[model samples]
Target chain A: MSGHGLVLRNICKKFGSTNVIRNLSLNVIPGEFLTLLGPSGCGKSTLLRIIAGLELQDEGSIAIGGREVDGLRPKLRDVAMVFQSYALYPHMSVAKNLAIPLLMRRLCAWQRIPVFGALLPGTASRKSEIIEEVARVAKSIGISHLLDRKPRQLSGGQRQRVAVGRAMVRHPAVFLMDEPLSNLDAKLRVQMRAEIKELHQRLGVTFIYVTHDQVEAMTLSDRVAVMLDGELVQVAPPQEIYANPHDRRVAEFVGSPKINMIDVNVCGGRLAEIGGQVLPSELTIGQGTLTVGIRPEAFHLASSGEPNSISAAVRLVEHMGSDLFLHLDLTGVPDPIIARLPAASGHIAPGNRLHLRIRTEQLLLFSENGQRLKQQASVTPLREYAR
Target chain B: MKHCRLSFRTLGRHGFLAITTAFVIVPFIWMVSLSLKPPEEIFQASFSLLPQSWHATQNYIRAMTASPLPRFMLNGVFICAVIVVFQILICAPIAYALAKLRFPGRHVFFNLVLVSLLIPSQVLALPLFILAYQLGLLNTYAALVFPFVVSPLGIFLFRQFFNTISDDIVHAARLDGMSEFTIVWRIMLPMAVPALIAFSIFSVVGHWNDLFWPLIAVRSQELMPPPLGLMAFKNEDTGIDYGPLMAGSTIVVAPLVLVFLLAQRWFIEGLTSGGIK
Candidate 1:
């Protein structure tokens, strides 16, 4: 089946005086998986609900498959949503849960009665068709053995798969998932994350996934839209969002253990942090104070008296088997800067002094208002100091 | 705490419960005993839970064969069942809207339901009578059932239960293409088995045991529920006819007791599960 593209234009929703979604617009190409990634209360789930037609946008229009669906009901929108709770009907068996959307769609009202439904013309065949499809989806999701059981009898992950299978039953043009894996334990979350990516690949359908977890968004989507306080801050590929984020918020929100932000004074053609020389750079950032964004992995070990290095005492070292996360306290800097180094950088512990140098190419420079700026750097390599 | 011998506190608590249990159960024992006793022993001054001379067979046969007692009981069953079913049908939808849907004046409407609950049925009896008479529903089953078709307490109770259910389930059902009524029936109703049982018990017990409304609503013998029919039976006899009356009372209460015993588990759970308070 050909996937349908979705276009949301000028969507604005207000919960009383507070704007939940403010003039948001985004376009999803056919057969692409796009994730709405944001912190909680960032209106990501609200956006998904608005797209599913479960909630109306106060002032916007939504078009799915090139048709405006502003007034259509959720089922008529040709989109299915898997809710955060999975929302599998707890009373229905897995098989009946899978058959509901098809039953509700294919059969007329007269043909939905319990025993009399079968006697009506075309109902018997349609019911068998529904049953067949339900079985197929159940088997595909590895929940065939669970068809006879109620949702409460199944584990959280199994219920989650059944929810996905229910959505897949109709083969809707677009699939909307609102934090479907947040309830599962960590181990199952990782396993199901791969399965969801595989499902998107297999169906080749437009998928809009909303989540607060950056790891899920980072690993799953073709494009990640970072939202904050009811506005889309940046929309780009996952690697681009991580490597060259549009602004400081996107950089801080995406990466784990957070990117280190140091406010540096660009005084007299040198980059200075806390009145110490970080490096001499010639990129014009309009001279004054500039914030330097550094991912924890950007720092490398250097000699104590390196010209571009800042000397710091190791406050803590966390071993992650392959790498070490060192919480270092630089002189005159209040917040400790974390550096992820190879564990083979031997014998590092708390109270040890080391000089850390910022790599020029990996340097992220943001303006005073937290906007990313140009970086065509000319770096002067450091001179090592004598004891 | 786990392995406990008889402590003074436990003993005292059990003693208090036993005394209270006897106080609650003594009247039921008296009714059954009077049903079984001869008329002489029933009227005698001496008190005993068991009958000395057993006249149970005679009293029961007379009560059954005396005056359309079986038909009165059949009427009770039919009316109570209809009231419960219609109460659920009417109350569930209203409760679903009040509990889940977002709309203007929703809280006002819910507060109105609570207000309606405060106005007792006795206050509405005269107006209900006039309405039923105007509609030509007098002395019919419709008059008996229609007045109770929409119960404010049922709406209030069902709404309280529905609030415990997650909104995501409803949204998912909507996306699954089920209509609001279908969701109420298939999704909300099944999950609300406890509340259904609890409300059904309250409605059935209330309507079945009610003599005042039935006396006011229906004059015909055929339409009379058990309590009203039994009251008629007592009044028609020249004397008290205490034995047959007590036997009939036992029969009238028997079905309700059996039903409560059967659904006793769900009944208690329902009341306490998503409690009103």
Candidate 2:
């Protein structure tokens, strides 16, 4: 089935006096896997709850498939959610838990009686149909053998799959998941992440997944909406968010080991003075202090006398299987500068001097207030020198 | 040396338990002995653990034949069962709302429940009697069952139990198209079996042995519960017969003891765990 698009307009929410969501608007195209990525208590889960009709937004309108659903209850919204705790009915067997939704929606009050329902003419057929559907969904999720078992009898990963299977049975136009994999062990989390991605592709439904994990957002989502303190910072593809971030907070929050910050003085419009050395820049900024952010991988090791290089003492070295991260202590910089390099790029010990080179295009300049500055066209290349 | 100390500790524990067990079981043994003894030996001036002259069959026969004792027991069973079932139906939803739903004056209502728990039921007997009389409900099952159908204790117990359940499950049920009524009865009631069993024991025992309310509100012989019926049997002009009286008491107390024996595991677990939170 083709999935339907979702549109949320000017959603505002408050818990007591604090505004948890501030006029947030989002649009999800049909059959797109969009992840809302944020830290804990950033209101991402609350937003998902609002869309599912579990919580009513204070001031907003939600439309699913072009129909406004402002006052509709969750069941009428045609959207299903998989909770973080896997919220399975503990007293029911797996098959019963999966069949409850269909039973409630399909059967009338007279047809739900235990003995009489079986005796009713069409009730028997509907009952068998529900069982068959439950079994089919269970088999698809590799939980066919667990149909008779209760929720407590399953492992964490198995319970998570049952929760997803329950959501899938409804075949709703939209699927909302709130950290559905946070309870698993590390290895199982990675495995379930891949399975969820595959499930999205198979169903081709509009998926709104909420998570605080950047890696899950990066790997699974077609677009990641980064949130901080209840406001959307940026919404873009994962690579664009990583490589070209609009806000300094987005850049810092998205990357591991964190992007490095260096305070430099801009001289005229084409040069930046850093630690008693002049570096050429293509940016035209006012003559003042600006914060420069550079990724760890942007720095590379150079010969001791290489031009346009900064020399500093190595403070520590962390050796990963595929990469080496060196912490360097420069004379004027307040924090240690970290550089990631290939693991086989020669031995580097602490207390040894190291020279690193950074490309002009790789340097990201931000003002003191954390707004990124655009670079202008270059007139000439600056001379190379070592310090 | 350590092995010797361990055995000594074990012996001491068993000795203490033995003493406590005798303290609790001696009264029941005495009651059974009295029920089996003849009238002449019941007040004998000797310390006897067992009946010297066995009149068990005659005493039981007289107890049943004397004054509609079995009918009184049937009434007791019907009344307690109705009260307990109605209490669960009325209390479970209130408890669920008090624990999960956020509405206006929720805290005030909960505080009122706490305050009601402090007021003894005996203090309200006079007002309840007046209300029953005005409604023309005295001497009927309505008077006997109405005041007890809404038990503050049951509501508090169920609220505490429901609080332990995760809210996500309730939300999940709502999203699955179940209404609040369905969530309370179908979903929560099943998960609260232990608490229900424990509350059942408390409700059944409390109403079964109650003499004050039934004496005040129910005056007809046919409407009297076990305790009042037994009292009526003992105070007959034929004078008090100790053997028959004890036998009747045993008959009245038997059902609750049997129920407790059958469900002691869930009862004990519910009491201990419900108290912890």
Candidate 3:
């Protein structure tokens, strides 16, 4: 069977009085690894459940491979789901768990009754075929030796692989995973992430992965949809999301050590004042106050007054082996300004006064309402703002 | 001083435990003693712990012949089995719905079920008797088994067990292209075995010993359960033949004790998993 792309149009879901997903629409291209990246309570898992037919959308329709699948149940959708808990059947052996879907498909309804099942005709041939298929999938996932073991007998990582194998045996067109790696310890999480990525490539199936981990989204997905409070805020490539975040929340949510944002008052023209310093004119003044975003890596230690420089005292220094994260105390800034510098610089120490030279091009400016300011081409990339 | 203090504390704990154990064991010891004693010694003011003479076989024969005890035991077993099977059928699906299925009024339904938990079964006795009378089910096992088929407590316990099961298993089964029914049977039910066994013990013991419902529902001697049969035997003998009555009571209690001892591991495991949280 060919892997089918999925399209969700204006999907709306509400849990009683609370709206979890509001008019959300998305598209998953065939054979593409798409990730829904968001913080907890962002409704990413809810959206994936809707696509898999595990949940129904209150409004709008779902189409798989360009066919409306609104009324069909989960089994009819040809979509497989790997759950965060690794939902291995506890009593069944690994091989039996993998063989269950095939058995359901091949065996007639009456043939499945416990006492009469053995008496049914063609069961032996069908059972052997399912076992063969299960073995093949188990071997592919390097779990052939574990076929006789129950789910609880296996370790966390082994259970996860078996969960994937159980899904893989079905050869579903689209695979829906809900935080599949969240249960693993950090080291195992990283290892399993690579294995899932490789499996996706080898299987060439449409993968819709959901995770609250931005790092996982960035590293594993070809495209990422950032959701917040049940709404899709931005959908783009990982690099684009990192370099050109559409909203202030996206910028804050996507990075480690987080981006530092400061509020600024705009005078009439493109000039804005921040921290009692008269900044150069690079943006046309909008209707209201604006917020400027500065990434940690954008800050550098400069000797004296530069075109874009701020004065501060070193509050703390965190040595990260190859890099140093400096926490600087600014005069008017409410939160401490963080800067990432190369370990070789060795210029920062707690209580030492310093001048922070910021790469003006790398600086991002946002409106007071948290919308990104469109940058003009002529102005330095970081300094420019929308008219 | 420290050693003396520690020794005193340990002695007090063991003393308390021994007293409690004796308190629980006294009634059982008396019942066995009465079962072994002759009628004349039972009414004596100065009581002995053991019987002067053993008439265990003779008492058992009279108890068996005095009432339809063989039939009564059969009735108890049959009613308990019917209740358990019906309870499983009715409660399992309802539990699945309460635990996993999302629909309108789910919390309201759940709260209503919780309300039922607060109300004791004794309160329902009169209404159930009346309902059975109206249905013309009096003197039949239907009256005894029908009302018990749907146990609110069973539903609540099974629901709690089902909820503890990871939703991932259900989702995985769904993606495996298994129907909702298959997911319930193959996925949810297997995980719910411990709960089912726990419910069975609750059901079997509850129905086996119950005298009130069957007492009210059935007037015929043939349909009476073991407990009611013993009650009938006492009434027929004018409360004088203590030996046979005690023997019958002993017979009635043996099956329950044996069953409990045999399945104590499963019973405790199931209870701890399903009830103790």
Candidate 3: misplaced stretches above 4 Å? Answer: A273-282, A286-288, A301-311, A330-334, A376-387, B1-24, B61-68, B105-137, B219-221, B234-239, B272-277
TM-score, chain A, per candidate?
0.95, 0.94, 0.93
Clashing pairs in 1: none
Q: How would you encode candidate 1's per-residue C-alpha lDDT over A1-387 as one tens digit per residue?
A: 868999999999999999999999999999999999999999999999999988999998999999999999998999999999999898899999999999999999889888998899999899999999999988888999999999999999999999999999999999999999999999999999999999999999999999999999999999999999999999999999999988899989989879988887786655555425445566575468888888999889888776666678999999999999999887766799889999999999799999877676887878889898766543454332211
TM-score between candidate 2 and the true structure: 0.94
Candidate 3 backbone clash number: 2
Q: Is candidate 1 or candidate 3 better by lDDT?
A: 1
User: Alpha carbon lDDT of residue A42, candidate 2?
Assistant: 94
Cα lDDT of model 3 by residue, A1-387, tens digit: 457998989999998889999999998889989999999998999999999888889998999988999999888988888888888889899888888888888898877778788688988788888888998999999999999999889999999998898788878899888899999999999999999999988988999999999889999999999999999999999999998999999999998789989876666745555443444445666545788888999888777666446788889999998999999888888889888999998666799988877666777888777888877312232344432
- Estimate how well candidate 3 is docked, as a DockQ score: 0.73
lDDT of each: 0.90, 0.89, 0.85
Which of candidates 1 and 2 reaches a greater DockQ?
1
lDDT value, residue A242 of candidate 3: 91
Best by TM-score: 1
Task: Supply DockQ values for each candidate.
Answer: 0.86, 0.82, 0.73
Q: Model 1: runs farther than 4 Å from truth?
A: A268-270, A282-287, A381-387, B1-12
